[model samples]
Target: MKRIISQCSKELSQFKRDRLTLALAFLLPLITLFIFGFAIRLEAKNIPLVIQDYDRSPISQRYVAKLFATNQFIFVPWSVNDSVEIALDRAIAKAGIIIPPEFSRRIAAGNIADVQVLVDGTDSNNARVIKNSIKATTNDFMQSEGLIPETNLLTTRSRLWFNPARQESLYIVPGVYAVVLWIFPSLLSAIAMVREKERQTILQVYASSMTSTELILGKGLAYLIVSLGIALVVMGIGAIVFRLSFAGDPTPLLVAIPIYLWASVMFGTMLGTRTTNQNAAVQGVALVGFLTALLLSGFIYPLSNIPFPLSLLPNVIPARYFIEITRDAYVRGTGWIGVWFAELMIFAIGMFFFNVARRVLSKMQLTE
Candidate 1:
């Protein structure tokens, strides 16, 4: 037990001595929390809508005025009576409201008064919010005007699945688990390996009785154990301190720990295979970490919200899969059945990378 403590202590000392790495490990998650918390807001608020009131009637103007009067929407004056196409082409509006000449007459005669709303489908999230807001406002108009009774109105009670309240923190905090784990193990192993190699201490290890596999296991396990500890600490802080709920069974999350650590360790080993210095290794890990966690992990933005083939990007990114799994467990109370696929994928990819890294490391002379 003392020897194990001594080994871990030495590893921790080595970790603390890398000032850049230690700072990144401690600071990045907090920085990311602030950025994602404030900057990446998913809730669509005060979406701009353009008006093309062609009817020139008091009733039509009243409807248009009511739509803008709501704090939920901002009205940009667009008197494009002749050409709404031109307004849409100029990108001067997200949505355009068109009231026809017969609009007032239809409303007075107890007929269905339909106003055309053209939305810029380019920004789908904005479009969705605008559409729902319009529908809600119009429904209110119908009720107040006695077009329908309060109880007899054709009403749809919309409920958001999974995240019912649509708490952004619930979506984001679980994702941090993946990003945090992805960073530490790679950063630790890469820096540790590069430091020894740069200082020429690695050659002494080769002179010893340790095989390549034995050396990698010793180094990778040491980093993995430390990284896993940091991950759990972050999870606890996010849950207990931040009040972010881990709604699922604790067992699945515990099961995923090995998967996360192994993936990070293997990725770090791969980085170490290519890098000759600690700086290069750290930079490589950062680059990969940013791309995988920040851009593709379905953390900062929803995968469904992106356009074209770019939306498919998260599928290939391992961090994204793990993030999805963690979020499901954290926010939705999903069990092992929900997360097993992600665990398997992480294991498979981690094993593949480790084998490749091991083979490459075997060929290289540590003395070189």
Candidate 2:
């Protein structure tokens, strides 16, 4: 115990002695939090929609106003001489609408009329959002103005539960915690362990009285403390800037954070041992730790949406589970019952990392 503590102290001293590493440990997570918190939006808005109104009637004008009423879209003014096709070709707007001269006449006659809609499908998601927004807006306009067929219809009312305001930060910031925590701690520790190899100090440590377990524990413990500090600062800043507040029991996150962090640092330690140089270790962390946490961990894309064979990968991702804990803590507040399995999975993954590192280190103890 004393030896492990001493080793931890030694690692911490070395970690702080280097100014760059110290700055990276603290500053990087803050930068990532702000960037992701402000930049990523699940719900797209401010879409530029070009309108070519040939009718110029009051009803057609009202319909255009209704589209912009939700503030999801902004109208792009095109000159009378310019065609909607030209505006779309120039990439001036995401979508274009052609309101024909017969638009109001058809509605007045209670006849079906088709208004041409051309959407730029360069980004399928954005195009889909614009299409849906326009459809919903048009439906609302017809219903409010009593232009409907007046047939009985099935109506379902939707209440935006948990996040009524549809603030993207509420959903985005919690997942950002998972990605930032998973990346930096693992990154810092990977570089540190690889640096020991580059200096040939690991060989001396292996030959010393301190067993492989102590060294691993000490290094893990040191980086774990650094990981905690990173967590506190990153999460604190997320709360202040995003206006995030816990919606339910904070206990699930309190329990899951350390376990998740253990998985992160241990993952770094594993990468350090596998790679011969700091460069390889850094690449390994970025490719495995950063990519998996950012993409496969249900941060931006839903795990179910990830194509088959690839979808199975999220099962083992520690960040995937930690995201559940964090989002639950802030949004759902389902408590321990909601996230107990995620906590267990994170711990299991951490132990798996520790075991793998231990086996690797034990073999290396012979200095092979």
Candidate 3:
């Protein structure tokens, strides 16, 4: 026990001695939380909208005013000064409302008329939301002005829930935590362990009575604790500084964290054994981390949106489950019942990799 404790202390001391790794250990998670939380918001609000009103009539003016009055549209322009197509092409605006030259003249004549709306389809999600908001806004204006069809049609309206304000931060913050934590812990551990092997430190331990399992466990555990501390700090900054709301209970997040940390350390161990230099280790971590985060994280394109076979890919990505567990606890506020399967999977993967680590390290020949 004393020897293991000494080994752990020495490992941690070695970790602290490296300024870059130490700074990354503390700073990376916080930086990821802030960047992903603010940048990748789920809800589309205040999208830039342009109006090309050619009619110059009271009814058209009223329509324009009503559209701008809604908080949804950031009305950047209110004239047909620039072409609608050009505005969209230049990405200056998302949606364009073009009122016909005879809009008010026809309204005065009690003739039913329609306006042409041009929406930029660059971002499908943004396009969808802006189109929906504009449609609702227009429909409401028509109803208020009694512009109803003589043939009545039944209509249904559905309200979006949970993220009532449609704030992107709500959806993003939880996922950000999962991706950043997943990458940092595994990358750090992989490099750290490999560095020990390169320095002949693993040989020194093996020369003593320490088993390969003990060496791996000691190294993995120390990194896991460090990861937990970093997770807490990242969560704190997200909740306090960025004003991200964690709606769910924290018990599931607490429970699932160590499981994730374990899996990460095991993965790091696997990578560490494969790489030759610190550069190779860092590169391996970055490549795997970015690719896994992009494909498996379910932050950019949702798992449901992907094809059936591709959805299975997320299961292999540890961060995907971590995101699920984090969202269940923080957003839905659920307990073990909500995320038991994810917790189990992480544990199973961790154990599987640990076994592999034991085998690999036992066979590994290190020199003094």
Best by TM-score: 2
Candidate 2 vs candidate 3: the TM-score winner is: 2
lDDT of 1 by residue, 1-368 (tens): 44344444666778777787776666666566556544666677777777776677887776777787777778777666456666777887677777777888888898887788888788887788889889888877767667776685566878776888777778767777777778777777777777777988768666765566766776777777777777766676667755776686868778877777887887888788778997799889888766767787777777877788878776666787788677877788778878888888778878887887777677775534
The residue-by-residue lDDT of candidate 2 on 187-247, one tens digit each, is 9988988898899898888878988889999999999999999999999988998899999
Off by over 4 Å in 1: 1-9, 51-71, 77-93, 100-102, 112-114, 121-125, 132-136, 143-158, 240-242, 278-283, 286-289, 293-317, 365-368
The true-versus-predicted C-alpha distance at residue 6 of model 2, in Å, is 0.3
Candidate 1, residue 365: lDDT: 56
User: Candidates 2 and 3: which is better by lDDT?
Assistant: 2
Task: Tell me the deviation in Å of residue 150 in model 2.
Answer: 6.7
Q: What C-alpha lDDT does candidate 3 achieve relative to the native structure?
A: 0.80
In candidate 3, what are the lDDT values of residues 9-79, reduced to their tens digit?
87788888899988889887787777787777566778788888888787788888889888778977644
RMSD of each: 4.3, 1.3, 2.7
Candidate order by decreasing lDDT: 2, 3, 1
lDDT of 3 at 323: 83
lDDT of each: 0.75, 0.90, 0.80
